[model samples]
Target: NLQLLTELDFAMAKGKLSLDMKAAAPALNSEGRIVLHQARHPLIKKEDVVPIDFELGINYHSLVITGPNTGGKTVTLKTCGLLTLMAMAGLHIPARSPSEVAFFDLVLADIGDEQSIEQSLSTFSSHMKEIIAITELAGPGSLVLLDELGAGTDPSEGAALAIAILNFLNQTGAYTVATTHYSELKGYAMNTEGVENASCEFDIESLQPTYKLLIGVPGVSHAFSIAQKLGLSQDIIADARQLISEESARFEQLITAIESSQKEIDDKKSEADKLQRELQEMRRTLEQEKEKIAKEKQELLAGAEAQAAEIVNKTRRQMEEIIESLEEKRAEQRLGHRLESELRGQISEVEKELSAHRHKRSTDQQPGEIEIGERYEAIDLNIEGVAKSLPDAKGQLVLEAGQISFSVAADRLRPVGKKPKAAGRRPRAGQAAGRTAASLTTERKMHATTELMLRGMRADEAIAAIDHFLDDAVLNGISPVRLIHGKGTGVLRQVTQDYLMRDSRVDSFRMGVEGEGGDGVTVAKLKL
Candidate 1:
């Protein structure tokens, strides 16, 4: 009963912790592996702390973390240790879903400043004491975290000692994570198998740590930058650089180049993703337009078919009614074959008129050129006539078809016979297809101005000038003339708006938007 109650309480507490930390329950494995993604420290302020990604124990059994002091290395170490413990205790860890952890039979940690005067132990002594114990007890199914390993000691001896200690723990089959400022240890992780390096990213310009952990890369201290930012002399910085070996300097340069290239690649990838999204959206819009246009076309075709069928049915009924009436009169006239033949001719003529309405002017009747003296047939009216005056401004021609005078658009007229020969002279070959003299005159009359700019004129002068412009625009069949009035004291705008409101020629008027010269331009639409 006690065990059951304890288990229930544990589950409830884990659920609450998961909600509070915005964490997911991590995967447990017997083969000893750990992978955490976007994992935050449980104790750190959530708003301020940046979550880190960490992986170990599969191909690489250990990882070395290197960066400047106080750059969240210690926090990262603590977070990894605590989360592992939490997972082993059946508590949900502060990490993303599908985060995996190794079920360790024993967990050991040697983190933080452990200097103690009462115990008569220095920081180095405390670290060594913990390291010895970890090396002895740690084996397969064990986890260990050591912060600033071999710190508070001599530089050369400490780095060498830290490497040896890490190697021993790794051989024991215990997954180890350690933080340090040792450049030698970085080299060790690079050349050694089953070991990896990670760096907490730092901004060069801001001289601040970005707190982003990048695995599979060694970290540099940037001691010169730190010293220079703290007001150290350039000569001192130069001397410090002189102390670094050529190999180490070259390695740092290579790392810098790699990072620069990586950043450029990332930027290009982001831009490509954006362009792909825009292209997909455009494709979707085009498909929708195609569907809409197809639907409208089908509707238009259906309407045309229905209309044609109605016209044919009405024509057939009219022919039947005429036939019936003619048959009724057959007895009075004693009609026979002649009357039937006349009736057939009359119905054929009516059918021809109705059928020809659907056809355009035939190719043979359409002449390349026609003048006042030129004779042509009207395909619609079915009459041959001489072209009188050339087309008016609207392309309508006055025709005299056997003294049946009428006016028709040029499109309705078509030439019938060949060009007549001049008296005692031959005509030029090209002149037959050339346009007439009257065509030029009519084209000139059709041309008119569509825009009028009135910037410097007075309100009355501008209004007066626009009155003539609008008259010409209406005559030439041009609507929506723009009037450019300078944005002065709203006087000119008021004058134009008032004039437009009263003018019967103007169908409507509106002010322009920014690109169209807002508040300074008025667009007036003329009546049809």
Candidate 2:
């Protein structure tokens, strides 16, 4: 499952990454790294895409783009190389073209001059080594980029070495782009069929490079313009221009024309400024309105929520009041039921004792109070009776007990304040004398037994109770009975079990595992 989720996440990220890359149009081999009207600085924060056009290799192995210093010569090199790398890495490139590349195995770039002090290699030596590495590794399928090539060393030695490296790479059929200030390399591009030359634009009147790229024209350094910008005297600039040959001077004149055109372009830029300002104002107005609406909506929601909370609070209070009233009524009802049960029990006991007393009075009375054909109670409280009539219709005393006419079941009647008449009749054969007092005492003794009372138990307490019950069962013969403590928090089970351990009376006991009573019941086995 973890592997499956990881794959799904990777697939999602890949698709998203692909979409972002596709959205950034880049110039590649299929569309030609030659961007027509490309507008982006090679190393500028927030690069603006400049509308300039150029081509690399429609039929050329190398395009040597050059222009005046501080123009876009190095920038052009970086833009092309960086975009190519970006594309190959499956990242979006800032370009406007149908850019694509057959996955190149290597993209070798030697752009800026970065000294390697740690490696103890000079600037020129480092560059030469990097160049050597690129040439050895580059093949027909590889892309190679070089910037300001052969500029770190002496011009004569550097130019010769640069030419040799270019020739070696060109022989390998490796695609390469190199930037150089050496006029010798421009001549090499002109002579070599596969090599091309391009230049970044420069202005003449104000003496500034347009920082724009142009193809089909190699460029020269604007030495005089830069010298003047750096506060050099006019005499020095004139002397420098005179030192150059007539052909170089004429090339300088042509560069002046391009510079004049750049002024005209700058003048025409006002319209773009006006459009940008208008867009900014509209965006500000929209944002202000959005903020106002958002704040109002938030306040309204807060108010509604407050009202809702108030209502809930009020309802809660009312519910509490109703619950309190119900509890009070339930308590009163429970108390009333208890009082009524207690009263009933007291009345029943009193009536039983009164019945027993009246029966004893009648049995112990003299003969005058219990004459023949008179009514009387029985001696035994369990037997309540009254005398009806004598047997043989002779008006003799006939005793009536509960559910039985008990001349037999009832006690004999006695008169008040007189000796009992005992010689009235003799006993029949096989009839024993009346029950003895000692025998009655023995019967009462036989009926006596033990009872149990328990309350408020935890689980261990319950187990102990069971153990004690086992003891009681063996001692008192109490069986097939019930425990009367009401169901409550099941602490009883824990306490009961704790107490049951090592208890001498317990044989075996367990929480009834199933219908035997679940957590609520325990069953015990006793040695008895």
Best candidate, TM-score-wise? 1
The count of residue-pair clashes in candidate 1 stands at 0
Question: Any runs in candidate 1 off by more than 4 Å, and if so which?
Answer: 1-7, 259-528
For 94-132, candidate 1 gives per-residue lDDT tens digits of 887779988889888998777899999999998999888
TM-score of each: 0.50, 0.44
lDDT (10s digit) by residue, model 2, range 1-528:
999999889768756754643335554454234443344443454444454454554688677876666687777777776666656766555554654443456778997777788988888978888887897798776778888788788998899888888888888877788888887887788789888877777665577667766555667777777788889999988898889899867765775565456446645665676788899999999999999999999999999999999999999999999999977965675465457545545544554554455456565443344445444544442333456764444424566654556443323444222323458776543122122322332233334233223456543344445544544355445443333333366555554554445545456666655654466555555455
Residue pairs with backbone overlap in model 1: none
Question: Lowest summed lDDT over 10 consecutive residues: which window, candidate 1?
Answer: 432-441
Q: For each candidate, C-alpha RMSD in Å?
A: 28.3, 19.6
Model 1, global lDDT: 0.79
- Model 2: lDDT of residue 364: 49
